[model samples]
Target: MTQQPTNESRLERGKRALAEIDGEAGHNVVAALADIAPDFATYLFEFPFGDIYCRPGLDLRSREISTIAALTAMGNASPQLKVHIEAGLNVGLTREEITEIIMQMAVYAGFPAALNGLFAAKEVFARRG
Candidate 1:
């Protein structure tokens, strides 16, 4: 039988996940959140990174792809979408692959959403370059 892992404090777990995911980017996100709602910032780190993202089933690269797709579909999460595009690259996705995924979204998410996602991705790529 498998032993259950001991629980850690939310912020502690979040810190670990943030480091593993992409330290600089995660810190930047949290820092931006700090001035407005520190509690929500904590939740952002704790839930997404600490709990869901750290789950064992999917690898980080796969998770980033799924996140990119979901954010693209949402159509209104441009800032968050751009962050995930960069995160996708951090997890080893190539610019070509990321662009392909965004283009694929046009079929289901419509041209508007796909176009916005592509633009967000373009900005991320441009910034990186």
Candidate 2:
């Protein structure tokens, strides 16, 4: 099996992967990416979404949950993390599960990221209303 690259330099991949799951959110992610690196979002559209997100191995719900966990683990990504939290909810991850996940992250990702994740989750929850 070939190992996939986790290097975020592949912006189009990120955009594409994210777009597959949530097109509007993917575009918003691109907008956010503009603040960091303009070219990055372009690749996200191609690689991550087009290649990874469209893959048949994992279901959307599982992928979204995994993404939420991964983002929480990365830390210092309140904005993107929030997006994933919303994605998680959209995919049917319950609030209890989300809170539990965030709580679990506190041990590995530290208190700050976990706390921030909870706050981000709250924001996403509010937006749903």
Candidate 3:
């Protein structure tokens, strides 16, 4: 985990990162968790956004690319994949780049996963358009 300013709490840093990266979609995910698992929402922000994502090693675009690929490979996280697909675009990934990333997954993640990812990308792209 990268060091955070002593003044900024993990939740604060996470919220900032989430807003910068995921925008409304990220906030919606956190808000949706409020009634059932508010703590999970906190964890989501603090851990993934605050700790891991806030690291300096990779830029936001690269991080989004990795996230999209991993989610696509899982083949069971279409909803999350959709969110990251949008995030990928938000961070400057062109549709062509996104398609290529998913297509590359077919070799390691199988045709079904790649197809599912492509479809999810299609849905996100359509929504954006």
Candidate with maximal TM-score: 3
Summing lDDT over every window of 10 consecutive residues in candidate 2, give the lowest-scoring window: 1-10
Instruction: Write down the lDDT that model 3 would get.
Output: 0.91
Error of 1 at 98 (Å): 0.6
lDDT by residue for model 1 (78-113), tens: 988988888888878899999998998899999999
Candidates sorted on lDDT, descending: 3, 1, 2
Task: Go through the candidates in order and give each one's C-alpha lDDT.
Answer: 0.83, 0.73, 0.91
TM, every model: 0.89, 0.74, 0.94
| Model 2's TM-score against the true structure | 0.74
Give per-residue CA lDDT, model 2, range 1-129, as digits (tens).
Answer: 123356644454455456546657657877887888977766666666656766678877788778887788888888778877777776678988988888788999899888888888888888777
**lDDT (tens digit, per residue) of candidate 3 on 53-112:** 998889999999899999989989999999899888888899999999999999999999
Error of 2 at 68 (Å): 0.9
Total backbone collisions, model 2: 20
